[model samples]
Target: MVFLLLSLVLGVLVGILLPFHIPLVWGKYFSVALLAAIDSLLGAGKAVYEDRFDFWLFVSGFITNTFLAGLLTYAGDRLGVELYLAAIITFGVRIFQDLSILRVYLFKRFSTTGPQGVSKTRPETK
Candidate 1:
């Protein structure tokens, strides 16, 4: 988890420092692919919280979702239909749902009572 956080921060820093651009025609594909990647990351985080994180599953899901989203966007452009919107909505909803679950898990994990059955109003002392 720490590694993942560090990598994310590094990626953001690099993105900010780099000069790159995606062509306008490929904007839909980029957006959908990014959404898919985010959804996969959130899903992986939730799985980790649930103690069910699988390396293979995360790898396959990340690749498949990203590829399919980009493919859908490309196909939609070819067919003159807004199919990429479907990918966007699906991934967006999944991302939000994953975040909600993670939030609840974290709250439950950290908001419990302390010793002697007393509710913890602040950080526990050593």
Candidate 2:
């Protein structure tokens, strides 16, 4: 319970802080993509193992991230920061955040598949 709450807080913090650094041109979309990658890599992997509220987890994360992003963007603008810079920063952080996830995705694709009859490949997390 504590861990889940902490994750939510962290996600919110990221969303809030992201717009301050990202450029406005592509901040929102990039942040959404970043959240998607982070959610897929961290959230989905666990969903495969834990039979719990996976649907709500993803939706909640999406909602919180977007809400925070918008709030922070508004705040940053009020603070006189360039919205474009903030958007760029958000996109940059988002891209950096997905590096490990992308690595694993690529590694899984290049490595091998599951049993001959199976179409899915399990992630090698170690």
Candidate 3:
């Protein structure tokens, strides 16, 4: 987890420092790839929280998801159809579901708890 967090921060810093711009014509591919990346990142986060993270799985899944999404986008362009939406919808739903589960996990872990089962942040009632 420390490694993942550090890597993310480093990547953000490098991206900020480097000022790279993707071509406008590649926007569809970029969007799909971005969604795939977010999906993998969120999935990895949930897996880490659940104590089931696998480095190889995360790496392979990220590569595979991005490749497939970009391939579908390219194929749709060739066939005059919007096939990338499938990847978007699928990843989007998974992202939302993972976020929901993570939220529940976080709430259960941190909500209204204090020493000896008391809630430190809860207000006293009359």
Candidate 4:
């Protein structure tokens, strides 16, 4: 997970340093693919937090989700339908759900209780 996040940061930095541009004609495919990738990444994070992360599951899901999203976007374009919206909506909802799960896990992990059942927190500054 840390490696993946580092790679993402490096890729973003490279993209920013380079001046390459994707043509506007491929916007729908690009958007859907990006969203699918994010969805897969978040799913992996959620799996890791749940202590059930699997390499094969993450890889297969990442590839399949990205490819299916692009395929759907292409079909929608060819058929004159805005089918990409479905993928976008699905991915968006999933991303939020994953984030929520992660957030809850973080809160529980960090907010441990004392022997008296008092929640642990930072001491107040004088």
Pick the TM-score winner.
Answer: 1
Candidate 2 versus truth, CA RMSD in Å, comes to 12.2
RMSD (Cα, Å) of model 3: 7.4
Candidate 2 C-alpha error for residue 75, in Å: 1.3
What is the per-residue lDDT of model 2 for residues 21-108, given as tens digits with 9 covering 90 to 100?
6666666556545554455445544454333337777777766765565566566667876553564566456556555555554455
Global lDDT of each candidate: 0.86, 0.57, 0.86, 0.86
CA lDDT, candidate 4, residue 110 = 72
- Put the candidates in TM-score order, highest first: 1, 4, 3, 2
Clash number for each model: 0, 13, 0, 0
Per-residue CA lDDT of candidate 3, range 1-126, in tens? Answer: 579789989998997898788889999999999999999989987887777789999999999999999999999999989999999999999999999977766665576653455333223434
RMSD of 1: 5.4
The TM-score of predicted model 1 comes to 0.82
| lDDT digits (tens) for residues 1-126 of candidate 1 | 589899999999998888997889888788899999999999998988777789999999999999999999889889999899999999989999999988776666676653454343224545
Clashing pairs in 3: none
